[model samples]
Target: MAPSKPIITVVTGTGAQGRAISRAFHRSGKWHVRVLTRNPTGQVAQALEMEGMELVQGNFEDKGALLRVFEGAFAVYSVTIPPWHQQYDLSMGEYEQGVLQADAAKASNVQIFLFSTLPYVGPHFMGLGGVELYDG
Candidate 1:
């Protein structure tokens, strides 16, 4: 059988890095970029839509919503923003969101999962520990 074109699904697409990467993939022509954001009708989504890229609106808190976004996609770029910076008490929400993304990936028959994460200083790192990447 012939190989298939890669479908790139970028989670957290409204964020800075996700949008840049999505644009790069869309420009490369080697892959189809799908931008997944919480606001599909927001400014970024509207702009990306104008560029001819696919966009899905959903949040990590909703598993069914995530599964719908993951369906038929070959890969997913998962990103989680820490809530603490916003002075929210639920700072660990990122981890919870990651867990939901992981379950969605497993049930979606997806491969080639890519994650953009925080930098780690050494092999024995602490904190998030790239758990977002590992979970995906």
Candidate 2:
């Protein structure tokens, strides 16, 4: 008998990057994909469900929710939107969210914790055609 595929939990699964990651894994047919989303009734979430990805409704700020979603997962793909992105109402800083996700993944004993981040070059290149990737 063939062995079962490993499970991977993806944060922000309703977002573009998260959805892309989930789709890539789903296409491989090597791992079971589980996605965490604040809005399970949203279009992306509903589409992911139809494509055989498990949906877990939750928010990044809720530790209990994160723990529940990450529990017993082989890996976690975490991606947080930048603060400047008007698409999301960010209650906390991006770094803080990243730390929180890492902590939750650790607590849940998740083997692989993949975090997506952008460099903070705003301060370094203050006046040289300054472009802030993310503020706070």
Candidate 3:
């Protein structure tokens, strides 16, 4: 069989890091890129869409929505902006979203999972469901 073009899904697609990663993939032209964001009609989403990227409208809070988006996706790029994320769900909510996303990634049979996290500040694994601190 011919090689299939990879489907890459980037969460928090409107965020700085997320956007950068998405752009990188788009530049490579080796894979099909889709961005997951709550505000699908937002400026950022529209911009990416105009550039030939698929914009999947959904949030981590919605499991059904996530499953639909993940369908046939070969890879997923998970990203959570801790600071701004905390504003949405009392930090706990942010953590929960991450965990949910991870589970969804597995359920969807995504071949590769790439998570983008802060280096110095460290990454938070929402699956733990607890608080941890980082020096940075």
Q: In candidate 1, which residue ranges exceed 4 Å CA deviation?
A: 1-4, 85-92, 119-136
The best candidate in terms of TM-score: 2
- lDDT per residue as tens, model 1, 16-109: 7788878888899888788887788889888988997888887756789889888888888887667643422343477787777877877998
Q: List per-prediction Cα lDDT, in the order shown.
A: 0.74, 0.85, 0.75
CA lDDT for candidate 2: 0.85
lDDT of 2 by residue, 9-110 (tens): 999987767888899998899988999999999999999999999999999878999999998889999987678766778888888999999999999999
Per-residue lDDT of 128 in model 1: 36
Per model, state how many residue pairs clash.
Answer: 0, 0, 0
Candidate 2 runs further than 4 Å off: 1-3, 118-136
lDDT tens digits by residue: candidate 3, 4-51: 678898987777677878888988989888888888898988998898
Ranking by TM-score: 2, 1, 3
Residue pairs with backbone overlap in model 2: none
TM-score of 2: 0.83
Of candidate 2, the 10-residue stretch with the lowest lDDT total is 118-127
lDDT for position 66 in model 3? 79
